[model samples]
Structure formats: structure tokens, C-alpha cells
Target: MRTTKLIWTIVGAVTVVLLLAGVGIVAALRGGDDEPDPQAAPGPGAASALPAPPSATSPAPSPGADITGPLDLLVIGVDTRVSIPDWQPHADAIMVMHINEDLKSGYIYSLPRDLRVDVPAFDANGYGGGRRKLTEAMSSGAKVRGTDKADVAQGYELLAKTISDYTGVDGFDAGAILTFDGLSRLTDALGGVTLKIDQKVVSQHRRPDGTARKLRPGGGGYTGPQATYLPGTRTLTGWQAIDYARQRYTAGGDYTRQRHQRQLVRALLTKAMGAGLPADLTRAEAVLTALGDTLVVSGDRNAIEYAYALRDLDPSRLTLVGLPGDSVINNGRYIGEQLTPVGRGFLKAAAAGTPEAYLADHPKLINK
Candidate 1:
């Protein structure tokens, strides 16, 4: 799901598009033949308070290690200008999905962009030390690394490391990075999606003095006219959905924005799961050709295989897990957030393959 953004918000959309638009990517692949194994990891109350979540039954894989059975994917969405050639990207969202070998049910955990973290320094900048925001780890890592695709790769390198180090699960079995515009393009490729809205909100387009810049009242959006999101279910075009998910001026601010992004992905997943992409090679290739070079997915081939499996996965079996925390001022000046010990435990539970157990203790954290 998103950049400065709908953090961890776009995977559902990616799942929807790639499964439908890029046939060769998924058609030749198959879900793992392993049987579904949902043995409970240590319950939250029984677990020790480690720096991060302990691994599931099997030992955790080291960073970048490929493992059989259950898989954990660190999904990243970044803001980038890939066409510019020189415009490297920065992560807008960071989300992790953990699934059992059976590929039946999975947990999606969204880490906040402004959540304070201990960011490691790059060779160019040296060690950052002290506490920093989790969002800066990648940009800081890229600064020290090379400027070519190497830079983006370094960013992810640091990103995956930082997240794993913080969460304390074995390192990710696979990971993926997406440019921000990929959301809009992919959503458009899927036609449009219907999103469920809790409270109403208007698009976040304002002039210097904070006056409304758009008033088209629904339908097309982003580059041109758009409308306020009324409470209820509404069908949104690619841009309209993007605009709706991008809005942060409403009550919940970025949190609400994150929520909307998840809703958008859910809608897209609904569409993707309903499609017969495997049977429509011609249409898939056409869709991919139409959106040439707009989306760049890099890192972890295993992650792509997971996408292949996602084409047939049930959307209802997936759940979004939000990190609960209060906004705070870090180092007195920087805006950041932190979770309570139990909240961190919930995160640990999610990472450790026991979200259902953690949610049993903290039901409020579950997506309503």
C-alpha cells in the first residue's frame, strides 16, 4: 500500500494488475504443493520480550535466504520517477505479509513511515546512530550506495535489513518494491474499483491559501477534476481511487489515508480474484503493452512466484494488520510514533505467524 504515503497499501492492487495484465509472469507458475500447516506459534503471553518477533517453528532464514514452506514477504511501495532515469525512489510505504506453507490465510502488517527507528548509516554518510524514523533507512542507505539501479537496490537492502532487524522475524523469504505511480497505472489497467468508505472526505487539492482546487463531484480524477468522497460505497476510476487514497486532510490524517489505501487494494483484489487472467493471454499481453514501462518491480524472484500464486488466492482469507501507536515528537523536534509494549507484542505476533492469537488478545487492532 504507499509513499510519504498510504503505507503498505498497494500490494492488493499489484496482485490485481499483474495477475491479469502480465500473463507470462504468472501463467507458467504454480502455488507451492506443500500442504497447509497452521500450527500455532508461541502465543503472545508465552513469548519472551525479544528485540523482535521470534521465528516460526522452523529457524528464521537469514537476510535474503530462500526457504521452503511458509514465506514472509516484505512489500515496499516507493515514490519514484523511473522514466527520468536519474530520479531514484524513496519508500512511501513498508508492509510485510506472512503466509503459511499452505497459502491459505495470511497477515498483512503495515509499519508507519514516521515510526522512529534506529537507521544504519551508509558508506557515504557514515553511521546515523541514535533513533530515526523507519522511513529514512532506505533513502539514507541509497545515499551511501551507488546512484544507478544499485542505489535503489541498496535502499531495499537496508530496508529489508532494518525491518527484519526491528521485527526480529527471520529475514524475509522474498520482497518487492513498487514505484508510486504504479498504483494509478495498475488501477487504470483494471478499469476501476469500488471502495467502502467509513467517513466522508474531499480530495486534498488546495491552493496556496488552502481553498478547494477541484470540484467536479465524482468520476475521473488525479490529473483533472475530482470530487468529495461521500460516506458509502463508491466506484472509482484509477485516478479517482488514487486521489481518494492520497487525501490526508481529513480526520485520521495519514492513518485514514492508509486505511483508504487498504480499501482500494481490497477492491482491486476483489476484481483480480474474479478475473480469468490465466485463460486470456491476448488480453493480458494487451494490458501489459498498453502500460509500458510505467511500473518497475525489483528484488526477490520468490516474491514474483508469490504473485503468481496470488492470482488464485482468496481475498477474504487475507487480513490487514495496522500498527497501533500515538503520534509523538521524537528527539523533541521530529514527528514520530511508538507502540506500547503490548502493541509491539501484537506486531511480534503478526510477524511470528500468530496474528490470530495476538488479535485474540487485542481485537481492536484488526481491520474492522
Candidate 2:
């Protein structure tokens, strides 16, 4: 058990994250034209294209078709540091939000960043297929488009396409990419979030033996005296929340990190409802600007209407699950994660709007 309370960390800036965190930003601002630009690699048009919005009467397009009711928004959170010049980002956390037309029921799924995949060649990033982490798909796709020229929009398109292929789902209705900055600011703004940790966790990098050291814990940055999270519930600041979510050193590895993120998501949701952050446009905008400097967002009016319809949604209705997979160092080079049959079934079932049914038969992570 573990948790991180990152407000904006749940989704893109204020708009998308608010939607997933279960709030009222569905009435979008056209000014959001500033979203990142991503161009899909040639072919696999099925993977890169966004179809038109569906009518209220029509159900969302089947797995691969255009936007329809009961939409799935693939929100990919990239943990990149702007302080580093020309830092290529990887999709740190991949979350797909499935909401029904009524918005009464919703679900979230987190795809481990290190989940492995076979990436085809793209001229911009220059990769010719073999095996690569699922998180690498965006940057690889962006590279073919030109590092300087590549934008998050194109990155999202490629990543969405790849996820669709991996899960055998149709197209994703909307997609957005958030960053660690969002997580930090949201946590800070909310005055910290409370999450539960199942077991004592110490960084393999910093506190390998679950003992505190004169270090900054497992997370990469900062100068501090070791980061340690005792099992049970704890309230965390923005940066601390990010650090907690960054830990992937336990025997569970990435799975542990994924659970930490979900915990944060729930904490944020609880905070947002009580804190009224979304209703506070000024502070919310400032937080958005600080966290999501650049984001890729796509969707149609139909999706928006449903978002509006979900205004009074109860956070309890939200469901969280991880794709089924086993860690492996397949081939000599490929490493990290591989999908299991159960995971594929979950994805397929999720796309078909029946995740709870699958969960009824499977185990769920802590706080999910």
C-alpha cells in the first residue's frame, strides 16, 4: 500500500486532469489552441487518426472508429525536467479514462511506462522496429517528425495508436499529456494529499535495505536525508508526492510505482471536491500554467457534452486497474514489461465498456 497526492498529476493541466479527477472543466476554452502538435508516422492510419464527434444518440465508435458516446481519453503523463536542456521525455504514466455517456460510471487504467513494445521506423526519431518500452513510442514518433519540430500533439497521436494496437481497442476519443510539474504544483496548491502505503518502501537506489540513509531517497533529484515511506497512511507535499510516486525499487518494481500514482489520483480527487480548486479559476489556471506548460489534447463536442453531464459525479464510481503483464528481459536488449493474456482481456473489455465485469473476477491494486 502506498499513495501520492498530486492534484494535476492525475491528468493534463487543469482541463483534462479536472475531468479525470472528477470535476467541472468540461466546458473547455477555445484558447486552449496552444496544445502540442504531434504528427503520426505514415501508414497505420488506424493508429494516428481522430474521427469526427458522434451524435448523442449514437454510441461511441467501436474500438477503432471515430469519437462516440462513452469515450476513452488516454492521458499520458510525461515526467520530464525542463531544467535539463533538450531532454527527451518518456510517457512516465499512461492513464486511460473511460466514462459512460451519462458520466455516472467511470474507470481509469494506468499502463506502466516501461511496458515493452515493438516500435516501427519513423524518420524523425529514427527507429526501425525491434522492441522498445511503450513509453518510448511518443519520443520515437516525435523523432521521425524532428525533435525541434515534434510536438506533444503528434506524440499523443502515435502513443494512442500504439496503445490501441497493444490492447486491440478501437481509437481513443481524446488524449492529453501532462508532466511532473502538474503533479508538484497541484499537491502544493492543495496543501498536500493523504495516501496509504501497504508496506514499508525504501529506494533500491537510496535506501536499499528499507533503512534511511543520508540521501534523497530513490527519486533522482534534490539533496536531502534519505526518503522513506512507512507502511500505512501519510500526507505528502507536492514534491514529496512526486518522490513517493517515483519509487519503483521494491520487489513489485513498476507495479508498486503504478499503485503509488493511483493513490495520488484518489487523494487528489478527494481534495479537489473539498477544496473547490476547479471552481477557483484563477488559482486553477495558475496551477495549470505552472504544471502543464505544454500539453496535447484532442476530442470533440460530444465528449465535451458528456464531460458536462458528469459534473456531479461521485468519486467512488471511479475504478482503477493496471494492464496485466509480467516483467521480462526478453531478447538481449528489450526489457521492462510485457503484456499478459489477462491484461489484453482487460483492455479489450475496458474498450468495450465492461471493466467492472473483468474486475469482478480479478484483483485490484490498493486504493484502486
- Please report the candidate that would top lDDT against the real structure: 1
Question: Candidate 2 on 98-165: residue-level lDDT in tens?
Answer: 77665556767788788877665554446565577888887766543344544555555567767777
Total residue pair clashes for candidate 1:
5
Model 2 bad stretches (over 4 Å): 1-15, 19-68, 120-130, 144-150, 203-224, 277-307, 331-334, 364-368
In order, what lDDT does every prediction score?
A: 0.61, 0.60
RMSD values, in order shown: 14.5, 13.4
Deviation in Å, model 1, residue 211 alpha carbon: 15
Candidate 2's clash total is 21
TM-score for each of the candidates? 0.72, 0.70
Q: After superposition, how far is residue 106 of candidate 1 from its true place, in Å?
A: 0.8
